[model samples]
Target: MPRETPMDQPLISPAQRAVADAFERMFELSRAQPAPDLAARLDRLSRLRALVQDNESRFEAAISADFGHRSQVETAIAETLFVLVEIKHATKHLKKWMAPRRVATALQFMPAKNRLIPQPLGVVGIISPWNYPLQLTLAPAIGALAAGNRVMIKPSELVPRFSALLQELIAAKFDAGEITVTGIEDEIAKSFASLPFDHLIFTGSTRIGRLVAEAAGRNLTPLTLELGGKSPVIIDRSADLDEAAARVAYAKLLNAGQTCIAPDYVLLPEGKVQEFADKLDGRMRGMYGTNPDNSDYTSIVSDRHYARLEALAADAAAKGAKIVQLAKPDDPAWKAKRKFPPTLVVGATPDMTIMQEEIFGPLLPIVGCKDAGEALSWINRHDRPLALYWFGKDAAARDEVLARTVSGGVTINDCLFHFTQVNQPMGGIGASGTGAYHGEWGFNNLSKLKPVFYRSPFNRLADLYPPYGTKIARLQKMLRFMS
Candidate 1:
């Protein structure tokens, strides 16, 4: 890490100087013309979605490269499906979501009726993270386009291949004036944040989310920061270890555990820690095979991430933590690949390096707590996470866990599935993140709710406006009564 840290960097960057200016010029020209008829906007969005659907395979290929062997079927079923599903749902409901909503008029404003119009914010900037890049970008774009605003997508540079491929795919379908995807250097991320946008949506690390918010603050731009925290998966003693392990492993292996909503770590019942670890190890190896690489399992993003995960794993091992090997690391399964095989740490404690950091890799850290209550307390001791998962048949136990532990979203008897619920808002709380977006919640976040008040020619209270006196006192009395 650079010693100069945060202040060492400059916020104004090449992307800001070149790509942003180009998009701004294009947006200006597009806005100067009459708004695309609502029908035309729909047509454009349709074309955009169709283009994505056409090149869906190509996007999967890029994501595969980013993951060093991400399953194409998984990509299609997960990432591509999310994008298309969101777009399809948005298209089906665009008219209804766009319809202006009316409100009941209070007797105080006798002649006035109320309307809440969803107006498109002029331009929206989306900064997507490396995990599930396609879904993040496409989901936000649907809202911007639906609300009649142009979009500039800044995909994570960590996944360069996917980022470049997305730029090319988007450029092939849309003009810079309508939507643009830019491949920017990592250094330019701060500058991207500095751009003046009506709304900005960022999904990434919590530390960087703060910096993005500050840069946006300079321009008073509203933002939706989707950051991450130590998302905990609690497995109660009363739960089925077999089913829990299978589902948790699925979530942990998805994108090689690179999802923002991926299970960060687990809290097991005391004394059951080793037993749970044993079962988890069996399931992971049984599902993925003895060799992780050749077993259709994916690897870490890059050598940097691999090394970081490796170091954390090594530190835990050196600190007397017992390593439960799910998939052997040295098996022919290891082809000098960046693959970090599924590993579990037993006898692990909060003081270990693996427990201290956000393990965004295939390693699972098991923390033993006396009970669900202890697990909930441990969770509360840290930053609130983006999501939490619980597995148990005990209804009261589950309810106690749910009622005590706060998270962006909760999944009962599952992991990372809360994010699959499309209709609800998805985001973090406190240090994890602020604001959320999914389905119509995303559309509303990207649009400006311009409240409209229409005053009729009849029963107008002109005196309440300026020449206030006894009339104001009488109006106040009526307001109190109405309240």
Candidate 2:
């Protein structure tokens, strides 16, 4: 028997109730209007693009305020421009994606045509995270809108200013029945998850993903969870050390290493650990300077997250890990700004807290491996990550790693570039996440590829319809033989 969600119990506030009512109204409106033409979808996408473009400075400031010191360049590239690119991609290819695909009719059903129609899933719920709040929220919304479905977005409560601003922007550009944005506290988030949306998308931690999965499960709602794990970077012997270090440093330090697909740890060639660490340190220092306050580095999102990251580093150091701070550790100004310097943790073990969890901060653990096989074995030993980055020129080694490891996505000789490709699907496999969304994949995921069959007026199945007789048995035998 299925467990029931108690409806009589009031788990949400009046404001949350209003949001829920809005969702119900939007869902009904989506059903009544059913399929939206390409022109309507394009118009929605255009409005969304205009919304981001018009409020670029506001978005930058809001995100910067939320993060304490997020660089405008980073916001433009990662958040605003990223979404704009997605909109452009969707707009350019929506017609092809929406076209009904013809399927071959089997011999058993000769003369009957079959086609798969990509239809909207009515109402979709998007629950975005705070790390890249604007991009995460709007990217999926782009897909949902392109697929002609109504959307209700729940921005993370962690970034209150950004969430409020996003709500205002979305409300101004779209009708509530078409696209709506709301911010909810923890209790309301639970209620929001429990709603019977046609599809739900969540981007956040693996732990919370489990709860979201459970709630969505009760309603049998399909979900696309963009959860995070300890994404690993493998440094092959044939790799360029300096180049690898620079790419890894940029990815790990971007958004203060708070990115979901950021290289959580590096598996370096055993004997070259120090050399690789040195190159990485140089890259970090060059990128952000010796003083974190003097650079375009971002701070941790909140004091709680800051304390948690500090605790993880402290726990690892206490457990015999060699901590190497790349920048000046005792800088009072950097400390005051809550800007943690990029650090490298040597001698990380499986039992250490830093190794056990996703290090969504400026700490990179360097694990030594003798060869490519050892590195592959180490990655296989843990849950699949959101991404796996391999930096080397060896074709065989790269292909071997690709064949052996399972992850949401991968980038060769670079980090996080796989995510930038609009054609490819970005998502996880086992634990990191479920389903995928990006490009046409995102549109398809939000839509139901409903199979349609056009039966001919000249029917041939009447002989096998009702009578359980010798003729029917013979027909079945002949069909089985043909099959």
Top-lDDT structure, candidate number: 2
Per-residue CA lDDT of model 2 for 1-483, tens digit only, reads 743333434645876677778877887797687599999999999999999999999999999888888978889899999999999999999999999999998877777899999999999999999999999999999999999999999889889899999989988999889999876677678788888889999999999999999998988999999999999999999999999999999999999999999999999788999999989988988898876666478888887887787788889899998888865334677666778889999878888999999999999999999888889999999999999999898899899999999999999999999999999998998789999999999999999999999987665766677766877888888799888
Give candidate 1's TM-score. 0.92
Q: Model 1: per-residue lDDT, tens digit, 1-483?
A: 522212234536655566667556655764577545578668877987887789888988888887777778777877888778877877788888888898888877876789998877788889998877888778878877877888888888778888898888778888778888876676567577877778889988888888999998987889888888778899988899889989988888777788788888889878888778888888887768765546367777777887787788789999988887664554445536777788888778888988777888888888888866788888998888899999999999889888898889999998877787778888888888887787789878877789988887786477579778788898788779989
RMSD of each: 4.4, 2.2
Off by over 4 Å in 1: 1-15, 26-36, 293-295, 327-335, 465-473
Model 2 C-alpha lDDT versus the unseen true structure: 0.89
Deviation of model 2 at 468, angstroms = 5.6
Which pairs of residues have clashing backbones in candidate 2? none
For each candidate in the order shown, give its overall lDDT on alpha carbons: 0.80, 0.89
